[model samples]
Target: MSWMPPDLPSAARARLEAARVLVVGLGGLGAHVALLLARSGVGHLVLADADRVEAANLSRQPYFPEHVGRLKAVALGELLQRIRPQMGVTLVPQFVAPDALPRLAAGCTAVVEAVDDAATKAALVEAAVAAGFRVVSASGIGGVGAGLAVRRLGRLVVVGDECTPCAGATPPLAPRVTAAAALQADVVVGWIVGNDSGTED
Candidate 1:
C-alpha cells in the first residue's frame, strides 16, 4: 500500500495534503470518516478512540474480526496505512479531556466529533469553538432514516445536527449510520475545498 496520487480539486488536494483533521470517535461513523480521509490523502489525522472492537461492532465498523479486542485508534491506523501506505497519521487512544482540548486542537484546521455521548459531543463542540477551529459533528445518525444535515458552530460550519443519538424511544437504522458518516466526510471535505456554503446551516 503506497500513496496513490489523489484525484481531487487542486486546491482541495493541497489543503487536504496539509490539513490536520482530529477525529473524536472510532466507532461506526468515525471508522468511515477515518477511512475516507486517509484514502483521500488528508496529510495529518489525529484519531482518538478509547474503545476497542467488540463483537457488536462488526456489522458497521470497518475493521476486521482480527481487530477484535484491539484498540480502535491503533487498529484503524494500521488499516489506514494498508489503504494508503504513505498517509501520515497520529493515533491517540485516550479520551479527550476538557482541559486537553486546546492542546489537542492547536495546529488542527478542523475537528470532527463522532463520539457516542451527547455530553461529550457538546464538550467537543465547545472546545472546537473555543479553539476557533472548524468542526464537523455527527448527530442523530443512528436511529433515523438516511439523511444529511450540515450546520454551523459559531461562524464555522459543521456537518451534522444537535440531535442526540436516537435513544431507546426511537430505534436505530443500520443504513442511516453508514449514510451519515459519508455525509460528514463530504461536508468536511467540501469546507476544505472551499465549496461548503452551509446551505443547511
Candidate 2:
C-alpha cells in the first residue's frame, strides 16, 4: 500500500494527479517549495525565476556547489526531474509580469508566491487574486532575528517576511531563507491535504 491516506477520496487523489501549480522565485523559499511539491506528487509545476545560482548560494539554497553559474530554474528543474521522473516540470528563466499572469495562472489550481521583493510579491498576489488563483506568499523570512510563519490570506497563505537587504540591497543569510521555504511548502501541502493551519491573518 502507498503511504498516502487511505481515506482520501478519489477526487482528492485526482486533484493531486491533475494539479497544476506555479512557484515563482528560485532562491531560498522557491527551491524548497518546488522540491517538496515534486516529492508530494504535484503533477505539473511551472517554475519562474530569472536569477542564477551564485557560489554564495550553496549554504541554504538547494543547488549543489557545482551548479553555481547556472540559472536557478534550470538547475532546479534538473533536480526536480531526478526527484520525480514522471512529473511535468517547466522552468521559465524570465521574470514573470502582470500581463503574463492570466496565461500563467490559467489552468493552475494554485500559485505559491516565493519571490523576495516586496513590490514583486505584492504584484503577484494582486494579479493571482484577480486571476482567480489561490495563492500562498512569503512575508518575513530573512534576518538573524527571523523565523517562519504560516498566515492565511483568504484562500492564500503568506509564508514569512522579506529578505534582509544590505545598504547596497543584497541578501545576507541562508538559515531564515531555508526556514521560510519549508514553511511555504508546509502551507502548500496543508492545502493539498485540505487543511489550512494558517495563523489567520
Candidate 3:
C-alpha cells in the first residue's frame, strides 16, 4: 500500500504484514481503530463483536443506513476488506470473554481493548497480557473536550480523557473517538515496527 513507506526497514514491513491484531469491539472506537490499523499495513485482524448495528450507531460509528440490522463484526469486516482488498479480517460474531481470548488471539501480536464496558475492558486486558500480546486500550471516551491524550503504562497504552465516563449526556463523539483510535493505532504500529517507546506516565 502507498501508506507503507518504502523507507521502513524491510524487517519492520515484514513484521507489520505478519502481525495479527485482535480488536475487541466493533463500535465507535473499535471501528476506526481497526480501519486505521488495516491502513497502516497490519495484515491480519481479528474482529470480535456480538452486537448488531442499529440506527443509533450511525452517529459515532462508521456505519451507514444500509448497515443497520447487520452484525457489527460482519459489517466492519466488509468495510475493511473494501478499503484494503488483501486485508485478512476474521470476524467473530459473538462477544468474546476472557476465557475465549487465548484461543482467539492465538498468533496475534497485539490487542486493542475498544469495548465499552469497564468489566469487559478489565477482563480483556488481563487475558490479552496473559496471552502475551502487546496491548493498547481506551478509557474515558465520553463527552469530548481537549483532555484526550495517550498514556503508556508499562505494556498498556491507554488513550482518552481518563475522566469522563460514557453516559447519556457524555456520549462518545466522532472526533474524540477517532482521535483515540488514531493514538491506539499508533501504539500498535509502534509495536509492529519494534519502536514501541511507550510514553512515561
> Candidate 3, residues 1-201: lDDT per residue as tens digits?
455888988899899999999999989989999999988899999999999999988988998899999999999999998899897989999999998998898898888899988998999999888777778999888776767777888778888878756446657778888888888888888888888845679
**Shift of residue 86 alpha carbon in model 3, Å:** 1.2
**lDDT per model, in order?**
0.77, 0.79, 0.87
Candidate that scores best on TM-score: 3
Predict model 1's lDDT versus the native: 0.77
lDDT of 2 by residue, 36-153 (tens): 8877778889999999999878877889988989999999999998887888988889999867877877888788887877898889889988888888887755456644566776
Candidate 2: lDDT of 136? 84
Per-residue CA lDDT of model 1 for 13-125, tens digit only, reads 78878878888899988989988877767888889989999988887788798999999999999998888777778988998885687788778877878888889888887
TM-score between model 2 and native: 0.85
Model 3 Cα displacement at 141 (Å)? 0.7
**TM-score between model 1 and native:** 0.87
Candidate 1, run of 10 with poorest lDDT: 165-174
lDDT winner? 3
Candidate number that wins on lDDT, 1 or 2? 2
